[model samples]
Target chain A: MKVFVTVGSMLPFDRLVCAMDAWAKEHSEAEVFAQVGETSLCPANMEYSAMISPSEYRDHFAACDVVVSHVGMGTIITASEFCKPLVMLPRRAELKELTNNHQFETAKWLEGRPGIRIIYSDGELAEAISKSIGSDGGSIVETGTRGKLINTLRQFISN
Target chain B: MKKILAVASAGGHWTEMMLLKEIFDGHDVAFVCTMEMYRSEVAPNRFYAIPGVSRLYKRSIAVSVAKLLFILVREKPDVVITTGSAPGLLAIFFSKMLGARTVWIDSIASIEQLSLSGRMAKKFADLWITQWPHLADPVDGPTYQGSVL
Candidate 1:
């Protein structure tokens, strides 16, 4: 149905945006929206924006059926909060895409989490998107815990 | 009710702070972060944005520290917590000066060791938690608390 792809706020992730565009073209029925960051490649198949304001950012994620993002913590946490299925593409330091390889480390650490699919390359993104949409974001996330983490927070604050 | 101040510089730092959302839900929570085109997780009244420290350049941290100085005075929170970057460090620094308890939960992305900000937080944070088991050093104030990821 609806897909939102975010490459995060700082770097260019044209590889992801381009792959997602190809995926959307194949799907035909899926609606794709992307926050492309400072990338040069423009997508002709999907709705694209360089960046969005705070309210619009949340609204887009909330409305999307699935969130495809770089392995940045911001994107992952936001996707988890919306209970949206996620396709995380880790940026590689060897490729000069990021300052370091921490995103690769994050993907390694997050391997078994529910409803999350980690793609090492653009080739894997289409399948993850297909799987996410097919399951209606049910593969990685099950029950939404709106207040689950807050309880721990309140306890920490009182002490 | 106790008031809390949450500060994270954005990206992984902000994400880590938000993963602890339970702590801020009902409290008089206020947040400070790097400038972004995104909205706050909480209400607008509870959020502040300052320039993020450029990891490549040390100058940005000083600017944000100056901005955070005033907010710390105004909020006068009972406690301050962050999943850190330089902004979080500055917030904690000021919070400590203002007599607020401070907590630092290092980012999970630091698989090998504590981040630069996490290391800086050691002298200030009342409690320091690490997501990775290997990074925990109880004597140094960083303890294993499982993961927020």
Candidate 2:
């Protein structure tokens, strides 16, 4: 089983790296790839965890058993579009890890959506990974309406 | 009567707000944002600058409140629309208190769920817009506008 994790901008890179390292140690049979942000807090481990660029971001999602991420809007929808089972950890405003508590809200919103799971802490993340190991990403998202949303934006801007 | 004050924290929020700039072209339009190094670089419309709110500075709620007062007294917009981070929350809260129509647009990236701001905004907003229908499940009311931007 393959697990992929992406921490987009505005998250605690060090904590993510620690979580990934701990997870990899416990599940040595599974292959895990974690992409830390530009300013990373990555430990010295090339086998399981490493930093990656945005260009290479999508390729891993295609093959992973589980996709873990911070609660960024971009990362969440991309996971859905790929039909990947997603687990998200919200960046907390109280922790000074994010600009605000918006990630908490975003995580709560996606808590039980189809093919998606919200993981509040590092322990929950490990459990989500266990659940997704053998499972394939479920149903495709109907993003056809994204065009309509864009159209609405265009009209809203043009009007 | 449809004066709209769009508030954000620069970057994606500002870019997202720009997507709806045309809607305000025909109405009274104003912009609100935080003082950021990037804000000077981004070419947002002449906007009102508010103190930034973030997880690190949660204690700065007093500063946020003061800034909100300044904005409320200065703009006095009839409606407030936000694609939020933190400053947008201040706008929504003040808008509600001052009797202005409030609309909150959950970001397109919110496919998995509503952000924390979206949840609070959903409660009191005159219209809460979400690009993802799944978000409506947790919203307490029927005022979801289904993604105006």
**DockQ of candidate model 1:** 0.45
Q: Cα lDDT of model 2 overall?
A: 0.65
lDDT per residue as tens, model 1, A40-136: 8879899999877656778998888888999887776677677788889998877777777878887887787877889898988877877777454
Best by lDDT: 1
Task: Tell me which residue pairs clash in candidate 2.
Answer: A73-B109, A93-B55, A105-B114, A105-B115, A105-B116, A106-B115, A109-B113, A110-B112, A110-B113, A157-B22
Clashing pairs in 1: A54-B37, A54-B38, A54-B39, A114-A140, A115-A139, A115-A140, A149-B22, A150-B22, A153-B23
How well does each candidate superpose onto the true structure, as a TM-score?
0.80, 0.54
Which tens-of-lDDT digit does each residue in B77-120 have in candidate 1? 99998887777887888889889998887887788777778888
RMSD, one per candidate, in order: 3.6, 7.6
Relative to the unseen true structure, what is the Cα RMSD of model 1? 3.6
Task: State the lDDT of candidate 2 residue by residue for B48-145, as single tens digits.
Answer: 66666766558877887897788777778787878887668778887898987777777765555566677777666766777666556543632333
